[model samples]
Target: MVDGESEAADIVEHYELDYDESGRITRGYQQLELVRTREIVGRHLPPGPLQVLDVGGGTGAHARWLAEAGHQVLLVDLVPRHVQAARALAEEGLSVRAELGDARQLDIADESFDAVLLLGPLYHLTDRGDRVRALREAGRVAKPGCLVFAAAISRFASLFDGLARGFLFDPAFRSIVERDLAEGQHRNPDRHPGWFTTAYLHHPDELMSEAAEARLRTVEIVGVEGLCAWLPQLAEQWEDPERREVILESIRAVESEACLRALSPHLLLIARRPG
Candidate 1:
């Protein structure tokens, strides 16, 4: 493994955050992210029973769904616990192969997968070069013309999150937010697990640039949660189906609006490897 990846793996192992990733997306704004991500990605997916690779697919949340949808999926994660949890899904009859691997250096063959999902690696790889390497690896493993869906935390995410949750009141969190805004570098040096770990948030244009650097054709970059990420009544609104549809519709309206992409907490970049 590369030094950057080894350090990232060490941080992940020390923090023990991957264990909760499975259930994390089922609540609050994360639930919205999950729903929108599935909807957006699902719309672009080709016919099923295709070979798929889920790089850094934590706990197999998406992998399990894809396997159930009739795709042959191999989920590779840096965290051992995540791999174990994903492997357990197969015991429940989901057709998934879970393995421990680094995103920068996948053990798979070239042009192997019909689809490549780098849902969690880019953010964790704080170095720009490391991030590009991971993206290039995805491109190398993806068949010509196959889609690669990469997710990134927005550069303004810490600021928005702080203002929304009133975390800005805390001096430490405010400092974190300031650094995130200035440099896109996030570091929870105090070991505050809720504050998140080391990461590099991305500007919308920067994400597209990285894809280009990896030789992938940019299709589109859209906001996952749009402007509803910090709604005061998100939990309550999500409980009502009608309210939920209204929220989803609003997001779809502006998801592709380049002017407002940075306002969203998470951004999904859809690109294709050059055929």
Candidate 2:
């Protein structure tokens, strides 16, 4: 295992006090992330029935949908519980395959998948070298010219989250936010599961740089939640269909705006391996 990997896993295991991987993206502002990510990734994906490798795909959230959409999906995750949950989905008849694996060192054959996803790996791979190694593995597994969708937490995410939910009132959270803004390293030493886990939030430029270093050509880096990430009434708004559409449209309008990308909680980097 790489440095910090065990700590990250321990933190995530602790985070189960708040919610598990299955229910995480199904509610609140996180729903926006799930919705927008599916929309954006679906938009870029080639015609279906393709082979997809979902690296660090916790509990097969994306893999379940991709499989239902007719693509063959193989999901790899470090957490055994998550892998078991994903396998449970397969037992229910979805065609997703789940296995325990590391992102920096995939056990699969090279150039085997039509598309690759590194949605959760980058968030936990706090080391720059490890993150780049994960990206390079994504490239190595993807067919030439195929798209790779990588997700990252924005550097400003903790600050915005703290402010939005009054987490900043606590000095501990304030210190965590400070470090996140100053160095992009987020460490939660407290026992509060809501404080999240060890993560390396990324500046937009840093994500682009890492992808470039991995020899992946940048197609675009778009904000997943955009300006709607921290809205106080976002949950209420999401319940109303029309309001949700307006919110999604508003986000899409500025999803790619460089100045506003950092305002988002999560960013998705769309890159392609050179043919």
Candidate 3:
């Protein structure tokens, strides 16, 4: 754990974080996440022979694609298990490598990478100082004009999820949701913390402000899986190409709409290190 954050590495290992990448892709909403993230990241990344650093990139899901596309990628995460899994990709001859590392104190050289990703680190860091330090480190390692992509769980995500899944009926869980809505902190105190570990949710504006505080120029912040993806029927239609495309088109159309973005479960902030 960092100075103010929880023992996030132990939690990640206990929860087996490696399943998220593969498991999420099976759900329709997560399918939207996969599609949109790749689309947005692809649009901004420079082509070919570039060094990309995936800070807190779990299990090398994004690293694999980036490497396959001819970029050299190095993924660092706190969980040793995730590092091992990511290293398996490197063993298979992809231009990728993974190692155990912390986002708050990166050992890599400054201005060393063409792009840096803080996709999972911010969500777990509850303290403001820790989050800022992580972002600044990302900015420090990135080339002056390069992009940094950071992801955050929306403040009201769990509230909406609880309502959708009927978890609100339980008094204990309802209280938890209320606390989450009030403070944006999600803590699992029980011995069995379930699938989700300790995390800090973020308001859309708050996430952008954090990036600016790190001196990273804000490019754009958009919802990964928009409100429409929450519909119950979306999963059923995933197998139908026409229906899936229509659903994806709808999500992409409103991804940047300010009012609608807060309804998304996850938000992405794309910023650049100032030249």
Candidate 4:
């Protein structure tokens, strides 16, 4: 592993990401993110057989589906456990390859892939320069004019989550929420390590600016779940197909509505490197 990759691995190992991300999209509010991301990504993928680089694609969650759709996928991640899990998915015949690597310094040649997905790296990188380095690498490996899908936790997510869980009132938890609102940085204290590790959430404008800094043209920065992503009650909608469909449609309908973008727990940015 490269230096950056090693540093990332050491930091992320504390989170036990493989276990947390397991079946991530199959249940709860996370499903909202998965469904919307799939819709946006599938809509922009180039026609015919395509090559995709899934940088920081933990445990092959998205890569498996891309390969199942007949696209060729190579998934790289900082965590070794995630790499192992991803390789297991590949062994099961998903047309994918998995390996340990850093997104800031990809091992591929320039313009090598038809598309790239930096789904989980940006938030973890924390520093602006580190995040920009990862984005530039993704842009470098992507074929000119092709899609690059990037995902980030929304800047206001912690506040919304605290509100939904009814924990923002406690003095200790209130400090954490205040820090997240005041600065996009998120750090869980020793008492609340399960809340999250070191992370940098992004405002939608910051995401757009980062894409621009990487020499990528912004296609759109979509709200992954629109206005209700943090509501604790929405998890119940998953049990009823009709309620689920309505909830799904509700989020999708406001994906580009601007006013509701910041309310989502996550945001998906569709961008392209200049041709």
Each candidate's lDDT (Cα)?
0.89, 0.89, 0.83, 0.83
List the candidates' TM-scores in order: 0.95, 0.95, 0.93, 0.93
Model 4 lDDT per residue over 142-224, tens place: 98888899999999988888887777877777788788888888877553633666678898999999999988999999888
Off by over 4 Å in 1: 1-6, 14-19
Over 4 Å off, model 4: 1-10, 17-19, 191-194
TM-score of 1: 0.95
lDDT of 1: 0.89
> What is candidate 2's lDDT per residue for 41-92, written digit by digit as tens?
9999999789999999987779988998999999998887788889988787
Q: What is the C-alpha RMSD of each candidate to the true structure, in Å?
A: 1.9, 1.8, 2.2, 2.6
Tens-place lDDT per residue, model 1, 89-154, is 889888899998989999999999999999999999888888999999999999999999999999
Worst 10 residues of 1 by lDDT: 10-19
lDDT, candidate 3, 86-130, per-residue tens: 898878899998988889999999999999988889988888878
Better of 1 and 3 by TM-score: 1
Candidate 4: give the clashing pairs: none
TM-score of 4: 0.93
lDDT at residue 89 of model 1 (Cα atoms): 83
TM value for model 2: 0.95
